[model samples]
Target chain A: MTHAVSNGLLASDLVKNFGSVSVLKNINFSMNADEAVGIVGPNGAGKTTLLSALAGAFQLDQGSILLNNQDVTEKCASARCNLGVVRTHQIPKPFDGMTVFENVLVAASYGVDADKQTAYQHTLNAIQLSGMEHVANRQAESLGLLDRKRLELARALATQPKILLLDEIAGGLTEAESVQLVDTIKELRRQGIGIIWIEHIVHVLLQVAERLICMDSGEIIADGEPQAVLSNPQVVKAYLGGGIE
Target chain B: MSQWTNSVTIQRWTPSSRYAIVFAGLVLVLLALAPLFASNGLLDRLTALFIYVILAAMWNALAGYGGLISVGQQAFFGLGAYFTIRIADLGLDPFISVALAALIVGVISYPISLVMLRLKGGEFAIGMWVVASILHLMVNLDGLIQGETGISLVSLNHYDSAQRLTIIYLLTLGSMAGLLALLFFVLRSKTGSAIQAIRDNEEAATSVGVKPEKTKQLLFVIAAFGIGVAGALWLTSATTFLPKTYFSVQWSAYMIFMVLVGGIGKFEGAILGAIIFFLVETWFSSTGVWYLVSLGAIAIAFSLFLPKGIWGELERRFNWHFLPVGYQVVEKNKINTDKK
Candidate 1:
């Protein structure tokens, strides 16, 4: 929250291919640290792939990613996370056999390079922020789906990320649970952490995201205000026509 | 809405765990004094059990905690023995050679880990075994080893039989205790958490800033060093090193059986598994092939029924944990009230 000169995340000319199929093509995306952006698309829209590329999950075929105006194309996933870009998996990937508190502790200790006391404090704060204090001592693998999703958010928050990339965090949650998650995400955005959420839940995503981007066939077809992007003809044809009731 | 309380304290050691520590220390001290009263054969058997403990614990830390199921540990075991003999041939005391050989094996494991760690799952297990086989063939080519006729550590003959046996027993015991202590401390630290996180999910760990490669490499090297020391001590006690016997895949099989019988991921399980294995081997050695067949049968039975191993089952049923590898969060007010 105290960052005075963060330029946020910038990705230019990103291209990625898997075998004979192209997943992402010539993508250019940018987001500031003070805004929340939502990405919505049909299946195989390269939305998650874009997030993966930004998070450095795999090598980009051709691209340059800049975090705070510094190129991070060569950095590995952990290195990118240390530089203030963190992500949550679409399906929760909690560290089994560890307590929920310990899952976030790993992020604070390694992501921020915090010492024991600082890391512990950060872990507690992340848990409290994500409303996971009740099950803080429980093993992560024992958690239900909603709590598991919250754990993913708590872990990302513990990293003290400037740009948080969330990949369909509310995919399988009930409507009430989705509302609760939206409240937590709203709180995060208010605290000045940028979030780029990829979701299939449009109305829920619209509650928190000021801006929205839509992609189809590995290319962004719409980028603007949430309503404006949603109403775009190409976006509707490529995504919302088949999705969104 | 009420403000969330953030005054919880993390507790790692319970009263039972604290008492367990004292009990373990007492047991170690009592075991250390065994040679003073126990017969030579018993002392020899105890020494062999200590070596099994060392190997099982190292493999447990590597495969159990690190998610690296390696069967090629005998490579380091054999290399450790060979290095000790080679170092002793230069006129060094065999005791010092044991330590030096272990250190050299640790260094050698770094490069080997670089190549081997790239392989995952079954590939890693089989790849390590292949590497061990290659090392065996290479060791047989050495002039000193003399094409599998092997070589004896003649340097050990300088000491009287009683002195040599006593020293070797002490060395093996010390190494087992030292390695366990090392693992305990490492698993209790931040790096320990990182390693476990990587084990559970490598890509997820990276998103949280855990370096999988570096953490796995450290564990691989540590396992090699400890297994190496065990091999060096074994050669010192036997005073002989046959390339075939030293690099035998049977060593890997022993480690797997012990970890499976005791518990795969628990520290106490490895020690427990090693002891059970030592006893089973002792009682059934006369049964020859039946000994190995029963060993396999027990391993299979444990896999089918007690898959978590004995320690894991006990912990699951009674919620008992003697080691401090995990954290327990308690509210500060609860602690204060409990004391009152």
Candidate 2:
């Protein structure tokens, strides 16, 4: 999270107001290369909003974002993705009519701007890494929940991102399915790609994230070591449903 | 004793349908040579068929792959006719005017698409139709276009009917085949992949670096250009350009009917649909307004009963493919050399 730089992402003074209600309140965030950071927040807490703004899916009322120490605050989502800042939607958004391979291949070629040979290699690597190789030729929409999420991750990874922002990828997954996803996320970390994962599952997040960020009402309430952030009284109060209930 | 081990060569690629082998160069050669001996009436009919095929194919690419449900494409189709007639009236070669009109209409589509594509789904569809009507009225104001009186392409009169019909028919045929090939290659290219990605999921496509606006705009102009040429061909056939008829929403209705019934998203569907539509129209168009009602009825029936359209339904049921651009896996174990 340090500003010293080395292929990391930084967002400063991020602010977004949706019709007078501030969804993101002057947030400053940073993540380093190969780092896995997790964000946990309650409903209406604006966690997804933060990811969207950073991803350029939404423009900030006020903010500047940088990828790999270069300013990309004004770039569209696709341009930001080409610059190695790629994100996955909270919901799986695989291209319905396209096969699973086509989805990843598209991301590999377009998002990361990989050349043809490289795109093919990257696509295969991504499908293999995300464990979607088995259903590579299947139409994306035909897949079930677990496979859809895998396709989503495979799609994102195929883009060859220097930094990846994940939003609610573990939502609606069974505990066992979430573990499989957590393992995939860990494998992504081993590939040296920086990750900013937003998840509702605290235990899964705790297992993978070295750093944890807690947000409530559009503001970061706690940021630090995962264990410490989870135990912080403000963090616990804001999220974690006030413990046992 | 020696024996063949029968070692199978396993590959990772998808299997292409063998049906394309049936559509080999022989068919193209036959089509190219048909007009030489065919009667003028048949040539006239074939020219109309070519134009509709172009319309159906372009509409399929726009609505099917790009998810741009524009029912107002006739605006450009009519514009192509008017522009051709206008250019031809200026004493330019009537045949060359088609290409010029296509380019001009394509450039015009850029600004228009920016405005038109801002609306999505039904609103976009309706917006385009309204735009077409406005264009139709605007074109009517031009005295050179002859307003409601219409204008014959008298420049083509010098060539005589037989020679003129053959040239235009061949050109129309050539243009249709060229554009269809272009559309096919585009869908197989990376841009096509990105375009389909936008169709399937715009937000997701954007997140993964597919430029929705750029891809869509490009497809819009390309489709406009193709449709404009088809319009020009229609003008050549009729030898006159009627703004009211050219700008009629019936063109879009016909395109939607063909694409929907044949296979809205399938490339082969456009061709097959156009062929079926051409035959049906020939048979019943003489029945007056009842023909229009039947077309409408057929389009509705296909949309309701066969949601995937004919080719889509068949592909799901029978795994039939004529233009299989996307990959289709066949397991290695299923590879039987005896069948080959």
Candidate 3:
């Protein structure tokens, strides 16, 4: 399938630290518009931290993050959101007391410049897209795991972001639910929303991401086509069992 | 064929049980008519209860809807009383002065919210307490407010005792009902949904495009205005303004207790809590330390076992709410004129 003209995101020498522990070290990467990239890493490899820096949830200890061509490294999360960059938490943090519909309504109204009627329509569409119509009025806290993950995606989609950062959204879903989620991601890609999925479900990532990068101790060890990156000697050593060739 | 019809039907299908509305209406009617059957002392107590309802409602709006649990709302209450008293000293009618005082308090609260909004969670609660203390100290030091001796509302002397008391009681009831109606309208609006979202999850709300600071500031100002009006009305009913009475932390504590026991996020909960609170206070007035002990015990019980409060628990169990906040979609039937 042909992709949209690539207005690639660029990060040069990204560095981040949590107190004395460095979580990301001189990380460099770029992805064109409509590109679907996946990052796989061991537990402490800073996959989530990198997503946070790119989403502007945290100030980078060092490095520049450019969306398209503009520097967004110093912007706050909301500011970056307005620039069409949005992220979902790995834990699926839907507003606990708010209903499923209300959650998306807020994103549609405030995330973009849509007016009330337009925002409402957009929110309804997002709900339909996320397949949350059955429980639209239910309190978010009352939802089970699968719905919570769907709510997380609905919220991100409502923002109408150009680039989406998804963090472990499939971590706890059943295999069938993960397949359904992967289909949803594929559907989003069909609409031309660039996606960066961080997942422990490596096979699902392989199904969706055209390119994959494996991280070990905060730095990318391999970046290439999915199969090639997964089978790279360094990736096999870092992720695959020690006995594997 | 039109989308609005579909939306209306969707809303109708999710109707909360009608019993909640009937109960809320029953309470409003009772409060409105209470003055006719009660003795003067009881009437005075009822008036105090009305003020408490408004104060508790404001606190619920701030903490329940806005997710801002303020322990310092009494500062606005005291400021409202002091400002009303000051304005009445210049010969304005006390009722008009109340409105003016609320406006002033609202304006002042915007800047105050700017500083306070910077703090989140525990820090925000502590900041409000500090603000309350500073205001309490300022009131105590001001010679014009009688420097802690307090000031008697000068205009109360102009009218006969009965006339003054009746007018004050009616004004308090009117203000309470009016504020309740206003809040009801606001919570039904699009902005109210945003506020609820913020309360649910600040980050999630922000991601969806809800500007947390703006929504919070707006609600904070409205709460401050409403509480200020309640404070002014309290002063008018009592015919005096005492710093200790107006700015006391106990007022905040009482408001919190009322909301917690009535229901934190439900509108009817505030009124229910206020009524129960007044009755408890009246019955236990002579009990002294036991009264304080009982109050604490009841509050703890509600928080621990009935976190939804009386109305909230009732609503959850029975699926009831007077003013609903979710959307409903309507279905349309098309007509054919084949015979014609």
TM-score (all chains, Cα) for each model: 0.96, 0.94, 0.89
Question: If the candidates were sorted by their TM-score against the true structure, best first, what order would they fall in?
Answer: 1, 2, 3
RMSD of each: 2.7, 4.0, 4.9
In order, the B-chain TM-scores come to 0.96, 0.92, 0.89
Better candidate by TM-score, 2 or 3: 2
**Least lDDT summed over 10 consecutive residues: which range in candidate 3 chain B?**
B331-340
| Candidate 2 positional error at B165, Å | 1.4
**Which 10 consecutive positions of candidate 2 chain B have the poorest summed lDDT?**
B1-10
Regions of model 3 farther than 4 Å from truth: A1-8, A240-245, B1-9, B12-43, B328-340
lDDT of 1 at A61: 90
- The prediction achieving the highest lDDT against the true structure is 1
lDDT of 1 by residue, B164-279 (tens): 88898888888889999999999889988998898889999999899999999999999999999999999998888999999999999999999999999899999999999999
Please provide, for model 2 over B57-150, each residue's C-alpha lDDT reduced to its tens digit, 9 standing for 90 to 100. 9999999989999989999999999889888777899889888988889999999999988899999999999999999999999988768888
Question: What lDDT score goes with residue A43 in model 1?
Answer: 95
TM-score of chain A of 1: 0.95
RMSD (CA, angstroms), candidate 2: 4.0
Name the lDDT of candidate 3: 0.82
User: In model 3, what lDDT does residue B38 have?
Assistant: 68
Model 1 achieves a DockQ score of 0.57
- TM for candidate 1 is 0.96
lDDT of 1 by residue, A202-222 (tens): 999999999999989999888
